[model samples]
Target: MHYVKSKSILSAKNGMNLYRGCTHGCIYCDSRSKIYNMNHEFEDVEVKENALELLKKELIKRPKAMIGTGAMTDPYIPAEKHLKFVRNSLELIYRYGFGFTCITKSDLVLRDLDLLEKINEKSKVVVQMTLTTADDELCSILEPNVCPTSRRFEVLKMLDEAGIATVVWLCPILPYINDTEENINSILDYCIEANVHGVLCFGMGLTLRDGNREYFYEKLDEHFPGLKARYIKEFGNDYSIPSHDEKRLMEIFKYRTSKAGILNDTNEIMSYLSEFPQKSVQSKLF
Candidate 1:
């Protein structure tokens, strides 16, 4: 881990990433794409040493709104267990009466469950987790470093029971590997069982660009041999690689999620995430 003074903390949309790069070692991470221009090693884990200070200043001046993180990097990376940057940031968010949301794959988030619940009671908090496959064994290979799909399901259930809204990012469904109906049904079952507010699926495919494309192919050669060549033959430099059975798979995704009353529209789900409870803000005036 390394620390560096950052000029700003929050983005124009009120998003922030206390850390840059990652270590989860997901075989297909978009953040690794060269387009981002990250200078350090992907796993070196750059810490924004002054993020909390800047966030506090920004929250003090800005109107009460949702404060988001973990867009480009998981806020609950292993370093967070000791650094407590995310935990401290949560304290600041709660103190200033701001809504909170994040995307992560770590059970470490449970450690901050109290803060999440407190923030939800005062305002709103949404937790988004990425579930690529329902099989823990496949999950171990696809997202080797982070907790498996089962554990993430458990976390989602816990969050729902706590009255905190939850969402699932059912994405990057590797074509031949996890694009089966059985896999999709199993994962959707978890979402329905957990009673998530939404399930974000932009079709049933994954994107691969320069940096991540190379890395993903390397992992394929290492683990699924001959698969790399197959990917090359099937998708030559294509950015969007859709699963062969995307139409059918998407039919099931929409049907099941809609039947369960879960939000399936990307724009609507995003609106829900960004919309802070105006009543909560009004209550603070008195």
Candidate 2:
């Protein structure tokens, strides 16, 4: 890991990525796409040395809104155990009375439950997690470096018990791999059991682009041998590689999430993530 001074931490939309690059070795990572233009190896995480400082400055100057992280890199990556940037950023967010939201697959998020609860008590805190495959063994193969879906389910339950809201990103279901109706229903069951507020699923397939496509194909050859050739034959450099069962699987996804009363629409989930709690506004008024 290397540290670099960052000029600003929050994006125009109030999103923050305290670290760049990732060690999570997920084969379908879109961040690896050349369109992002990272200068270093994906695993050589780039730490924004001044992220917390910049966050404090930005929070002070900007109007209160939900401050999000983990879009570009999971803020709770293993590096967080020592660096503690994500934890410190939460402290700052709580101190300044801003709502907080983050997308992560790590169970390490439970470590900061105190801060999340505090923030939710004052404003809002939404914990969004990604669950692609329900089977532990398959989960290990797909998201090798992170906690399995089972543990993430526990994290969601924990967040619910703490009175913090939660969302799930049920996505990037590899076409011939984890795109089965059983996998989708299993993950939705976990969401239902955990009482997640929403499940964000764009579709039942993954996207492949230049940099990520090469990496994904390499891993496919290593793990699922001969699958790479099939992908080439079938997809042939297409960006959106929808599953053969995408239509049927999406029906199951929508039906399950709708029955559970979980927000399944992407727009609704994004709006929920961005909305600041009215309680925070009232507190400011008083």
Candidate 3:
């Protein structure tokens, strides 16, 4: 891992990525895309030096607090286990009494569940887990290095049962791959079973760009064989790879989440995430 000095700690949208590259080694990782201009290797994690310190300083300066991270890279990458930067960052969020949230594929977040609970109790904390495949072995092929989907569902369920809300990023359903309607319904079923607050899926398809595109095609040749040729024949250089079953899967997602009373659309889910609860406003104000 390497260290770099970042000019700012938060994005315009209130999100922060404490690291540049990821170590989880998700074979289909979009962070590998060259567009992000990550100077270092994909696995060579870049630590934002003094990220917690910067976060503390930023929190002190901000008149209104709404901080989040783990969008580009998993904040709880294995490096976090040793550096404890993410944990310390969460502690600072809790100390400053700001809302906290993160997106992670690792169960490592469980280590900080206690802190998460405290934040949720006092303010807000939402955890987002990506569930692409229900089959464990296939999950190994797609994500490769992260925890299995089952465990992620378990974490989601556990969070919901604990009264802490959760959201699922049901995404990257690679065409000619894991894009079956059955797979979508199964994941949506899990979200319903977990009683999650929402499901964020713009569409039942995958978007491939320059860097991640080549990596994904290569992996396809290795794992599914002949699939890369199919992708080329179908998608060419086009970005979106909508599955043949997109419409059906989306209908299922809508029906399932609607019945479960879970927010199913991207707009709704994002609004829920970005919304600062009136309760927090009232308490923090007076």
**Candidate number that wins on lDDT, 1 or 3:** 1
Clashing pairs in 3: none
| Candidate 3 Cα errors over 4 Å, as ranges | 280-286
Question: Which candidate has the top score in lDDT?
Answer: 1
Model 1 TM-score, 2 decimals: 0.97
Over the stretch 229-253, how does candidate 2's per-residue lDDT look in tens digits? 9999999999999999989999998
- Number of the candidate with higher lDDT, 1 or 2: 1
Candidate 3 lDDT: 0.84
* Candidate 2 vs. true structure, TM-score: 0.97
**lDDT over C-alpha atoms for residue 161 of model 2:** 94
Candidate 1 residue lDDT tens string, 1-286:
7899999999999999999999999999999999999998999999999998999999999999999998899998999999999999999999999999999999999999999999999999999999999999988988998999999999999999999999999988998999999999999999999999999999999999999999999999988989989889999999999999999999999999999999999999999999999882334555
lDDT of 2: 0.92
Models ranked on lDDT: 1, 2, 3
List the candidate 1 regions with Cα displacement exceeding 4 Å: 280-286
Q: What is each predicted model's overall lDDT from 0 to 1?
A: 0.94, 0.92, 0.84
TM-score of every prediction relative to native: 0.97, 0.97, 0.95
Worst 10 residues of 2 by lDDT: 277-286
lDDT of 1 at 115: 97
